[model samples]
Target chain A: MKMAILVIAMLVFANQTLFEQLKEKCELSKNEYLIVIFQTPGNCVKCFIEPMDLVELIKKNSLGINYKLMALVSVEREIELKVFQKENDWKHYMLVDDGNARKDLGAKGIAMMIILDSRGKIMAEFLPNQYDKNIEKAKKFVKSR
Target chain B: MKIILITFVTLTLISSNCTMKTQHILEYKPEKLQTQNLNKINIEPKGIIEIEEDENNIIQQITSVAIIGESNTLALINGKDLLFYDNTTGKFIKKIEATFEMTDLVAKSGRKPYIDSNYERRKVEVPYISTTNYTQNGIDGEIAQQFIKNFFMSLKNINNTFYSFGTIYCYYIGSSEKSIDNIPVLFVLNDELNIESYVVMDLNKNSHAIAYDFYINNYIYLSAPGMYKVPAFGGEFDSYPTAAKYDLEGNFIKSVSHMTNNYLLKGGLKNGWVYPRFIEVNNHIMIVYPEELAVFGENKKLFDLQNLPFKNDSGFVYYQDYLRYCRSKEMRPDIDVIARLFPIKIIDAFENENKFYPIILVWDKNKPMGFYYLIQEYTSDGKLLREVALDDEPENQIRQFAFNKYDKELVLFKKSKTSWTAEKWSLR
Candidate 1:
């Protein structure tokens, strides 16, 4: 089930029209790397406030300018997501998924970030507990390429 | 020199004396929510049992576990699958072939699993899956969908039989205009993991659903929170924090009125739903409030820890902080706001020798290490028996745990890179 979702997500993004839509939605594009973040509810107190924390990190250039960002937020409650988005003022485009995107991407109940290349190939996947570890290597790889 | 000589003489006399009263002066129970009288019980870590997993059974995580004394097999739930292991040694036996699909009904993400209406007939193919919602049902509210015989929601053990507490949303499935009726039932399972018998515990409040269930010696106590306005249907909010009592066979015995919340129109403010972490201790219902522990005796008024000399100041506290905390995980744990400033939850309980103990994961804000977590054991009489420190590695060293009464061993499910392992620690 997870592989099928991944293949379908990859195929959708891999397509030219959908890729163009993605670029237009975020109003940004590049040939380097795209960072897709999967947000889930009910893990820790950290998970609930993650969007604002993440935005703070990006504003301080903590993530470095190696990739464009997209958020695949689990739409457990649409109103709650809207409140988070409004309060955090996240500039990146967020795709509201009522589907099992978090479960399929293996985020389960934690926040996950996957760095994908232009061809929809996963370059680096940073999981929960420690989302900062090995993130610099991915940023370096993206910048070097 | 004089004091030393007196001590020497006392020690000599004490050593010479044989008759001594070693039991029951009735240790004092605390009167307030002030942190006090907690003793640290030390236990050495036993060796880790690497639960071998293969291509077939890839255990990503575990949520709940039980030690089936009669069968001599330990049971665990990961997602929807129930895995069994040897009780003595934590060895993977087999993942039962009991995954049922709930097709006809739409996959409602957060609805209670009332679909277990087909449970009595053993119709394995009907009721669905999903363990997303956490209610007053407490920590054991995991693996709540359809497994073997629709066995889920509050998997508790009384002696040898496995009892599961669940809500049966019984309306006219035979076609009713009004919404479904709320009927909470307790299903007892046999040694072979079959639903032997069940009792329909009617709390008489059909409009309100039960939050948590605690089956003490003679009766079952449940926290039934009042109703809140639903967004989908746009309904009325009529909820009260009620501690109800029932018999083992699901009969409504009585109820104890609790101090209402000062927050919103209803319910205590906390993460993972209402009915603050509660337990039955000393024949009194111990309700974990924000800044207080409300205890109620049978057919008595709600009071604090010390008998009837207790007071409840719950009406002034607003529940919006908790509701906000549930939605936005911002941490501003003010004293009278979120008592459970951290993740306060009852992990699981165990019976050792002849006493009942509930294990709770609590946090100490002033703990030196920034975020100090320890597993606290509370005696049946509502005393903080002892606590053991959990390894603070940050990424989640211990996710879930189950205690085996006979062996007096605690099985901790720790996740490695890809596989899962069990660490056995004897807390005797």
Candidate 2:
């Protein structure tokens, strides 16, 4: 009974550590909230909206939120991405998730958005369209620095 | 100096990798290569292929074009719709709305009708059919069969041998027990758009190559692998065998043509520029970076290649590493545009009197870059037969140009003050 309880605690601690590392890697520990936009696999040319155009809104500062905006690009070319980031003066951070590392975390489908709290727990999740509907909700979570 | 020169010349036609073909590569003989005997020919404008204008200014340009049914050429604009125009007169034949079937099972609510007033194509939500489940490896022949029926471009399923269609499709293959497997599959649609066979082409997220301008002559010459794919139009030496000659039944024949990028790497280029055939004319260099076949010949051309590279005002850096004569940043815009330009050995092969004569369109260094093209026709043996100066008046500057092989005419997409129009010119 004692060994089983110990193993359970260790698993929980490991889960927390994974999230803590992700938060640190994304540099979101300094910020109160982070809104992550996950791109789908295999770029669909004729998708409902051009994925980059929707993501460009965050880069253009049109989102009007203090929350740290991030886009996870699922591409292998890091150098090309860096060149793009530097050339465009990409303000927000883009985590290259070529392996789909966050798939288990429920960030599934095309341009999926997920909001995480300071401690790394997912605070609020929005649909592809819900983020626009709940823009005020995202702003409310932004604790005053 | 001679030994190093011999090694470098031999490397140009060194051929492709494991998924490559060496059987059909033309034997290269540096000593026996032909000389330039090109007679100059005048470009005669036949007619204009007036592209139908979209008043709202949404359609940018024709992204993909294919010769369909001998008489017409199908143009895919902005990946939104397919517009058919007559090959001769450029008359509007018909237009089909390219629709998307939305199936985001994970983000259910996220898949709502995203209606934006500024742009209005986001409101569509067609039902996506999901049925494929991968159990075994190798080509999924059955799924390849289903893909043709799902091809959304045509108004209805093609009933006759009106066209030979080829599309690079991304299919999600995995069962409930397994994770989602993403692979790009190409099903060659021939004889009434029937998915008769399959070929394993890794034209995917990883490959720095693309094949679009393809012609079928028993074997599909789907734009040789070395196409103008990346932003640095001349990209890194990609190993993926995206270009190949395949029979109608999708049997691998030969990976016929390829430019050895490893040769550039050997020449101390780290991020290798997609430099076409190793040829130089005077101090000026030329390119063979077209859709297909940069006519393989002797490495004698590589010997004369002088590294005179030029940079433009728009931070447009051309020919980065291999041939390096930048000297320093002192290479300024005050220098003429011709000083900074390198010739791209363009591909549009010709046939006359039962003989194959490949056309090499060089950038007219005398005129400002992109304003004009110097069309140089060469015999199959690399003999420059004739050279014609494409009409390069500044007033009638063209935005884009293509040689319609079906009609045997050079179509120039001229950008006028009011709209973009295509002018077809005869090549004889």
Q: B1-428, model 2: which lDDT tens digit per residue?
A: 99998887766445233113211111211122233544666568787766655432223444544444353654443333445556556656565432222122211212122222332332233212233322343435453433322122211112223332323333332221212222112334453334454343332222322334343444544433332223221333433233345565434464433344433322312334233322222222223344223333221122111111221211112323212322222121222332323233344433433224334444434456542455655433445456665555565555455555556666677654454577777766
Task: Count clashes in each candidate, considering only residues at least 3 apart in sequence or on different chains.
Answer: 7, 11
CA shift at A138, candidate 1, in angstroms? 35
> Chain B vs. true chain B: TM-score for each candidate?
0.58, 0.51
TM-score quality measure for candidate 2:
0.45
Cα miss at B6, model 1 (Å)?
Answer: 80
Which window of ten consecutive residues has the lowest lDDT sum in model 2 chain B?
B22-31
Q: How accurate is candidate 1 locally (lDDT)?
A: 0.48
Model 1 residue A28 CA deviation (Å) reads 13
Candidate 2 segments exceeding 4 Å error: A1-145, B1-38, B54-59, B64-80, B96-167, B171-210, B223-242, B261-263, B266-294, B297-341, B345-365, B368-371, B393-396, B399-408
Structure candidate 1, residue pairs in collision: B136-B211, B136-B212, B137-B211, B226-B239, B227-B239, B263-B318, B263-B319
Evaluate fnat for each of the predicted models and list the values in order. Answer: 0.00, 0.00
lDDT of 1 by residue, B233-327 (tens): 01223234345666776565655434333323333333323444344444445555433333334423244332211223332233343444433
Candidate 2 residue B69 C-alpha distance from true site, Å? 9.3
Q: What DockQ, between 0 and 1, does each candidate earn?
A: 0.04, 0.02
